[model samples]
Target: MQNSLQGIELFKASVSISHQENCASGTCIDKNLLENYPPELIVGFQLLESVERSGTRRFAIHCGSADNQQHNGLLAWVFNTDLRYSFKDTSSASRSISAKCAMKVFYKHVANVQPLVNPDLGMPSVTSLEELRLPLHIYHCIKTVLEKSTSLLPPSGRKFGEWEIGLLDLESA
Candidate 1:
C-alpha cells in the first residue's frame, strides 16, 4: 500500500536526519545517544510466520523500534488474507510471545470475518500485495540472531504494544 511504503520511507528519512544532527555536533556519537533516538523514528517490521488456507495467505508481522539494543517492544500486525483486511493488535503481553501462538491468534480472530476491503487502504488502487514487501531489519537483527539468537529478542520486562501507528498518527502534523 502507498501509505505503508510512504511510512517506511519517512522512518528512513527521520533516522538520516537524526544521524546528521548527531554528526553536526562535532563529537563522537555516544552509544546511548544512538540507542535512545526516539522509538517512534525507528520503526521496523518482520514477517514472523504466514499461513495459507484456501486461496488466501495470512501473515503475522512483528513491528517496532529497529533498535534491538534498546529495551523497546514490538507491535503485532496481522494480514487477514481471508478477509482481505489488515488489523493491528496493540495488546500488552510478555515481551516475546511464541511465534506459533501469535500465528494462531491472528488467524483465529480474522478467520470468521467477511471479506472486505481494508479500511486502512482508503480508496481502491492498482497496487497488489504481492508487489509490496514490508521493510525489515535484516542486517541489524538477523546478524545478531545468527550469532546469538537471544540477542535479538526483546528484553523480558519491556512493554509491548506501545508503537505508534506509523505515519498515520503524523498525518495532521
Candidate 2:
C-alpha cells in the first residue's frame, strides 16, 4: 500500500548520559543511582529537502527526563516547512491540512518508538538505559491534549475518545 504521509529523512540522532555530575571522574560510583537515569535525547529531521516545492521542512528533538524512566511520550513541532502559510493564515484550508499532516508525522514517530517505551512484558514504572526517557513535561502535554480533545466530544463519544487517541495503548512508564 502507498503511504499518504511524506517520509521523514533523519539527519541526525544521538544519545548521551544524563546527570554528568553523577559520572564524576568518569566513574559511576553510585550504580543504583545511575540505573534508569534519563539520557539526553536528540533527533533531527530534514523532510523532503530535495523537493523544490517542499520548502524548508526541519525540526529537532532535544529533551531529557528528570524522572529517569522510559520516554513515555514525544514532543514534536514543525520548525519550518511549506506549511508556513498555514500558520500565517489559520482560516485557510491549508491550515487544517497542514495540522493533520503534522500530527500524522508526530504520531508516526511515537508509534515507531512505542515498543521501546513500553516493553513487551508489561509497563514498568522506570525505564532502563536502553529505553527512551520521556520528560514529565512532554508526558503532561500529551495527557492534557488527549483530555482536552475528549472534552470536546459529546458525552457518549467521550467514552471512546481515549481509545481513538491511542493513549490507552501507550502504557505509562
On a 0 to 100 scale, what is the lDDT of residue 71 in model 1?
24
RMSD of 1: 16.1
- Model 2, stretches more than 4 Å misplaced? 1-133, 161-173
Q: Over all chains combined, what TM-score does candidate 1 have? A: 0.21
Error of 1 at 86 (Å): 20
Write one digit per residue (lDDT tens) for candidate 2, span 6-39: 5533223222334656455866555544334111
Residue-wise C-alpha lDDT for candidate 1, range 1-173, written one tens digit per residue? 24634553443312422243537664666555453332222222222222232222322222223322222212223332122113233354544332211121111112211112222345553222211112455223422322232232346512224421111111110
Error of 2 at 136 (Å): 1.5
Report the number of clashing residue pairs per model: 0, 2
lDDT for model 2? 0.33
| Total colliding residue pairs, candidate 1 | 0
Q: Report how far off residue 135 is in candidate 1 (Å).
A: 8.0
List clashing residue pairs in candidate 2.
71-132, 71-134
TM-score of each: 0.21, 0.25
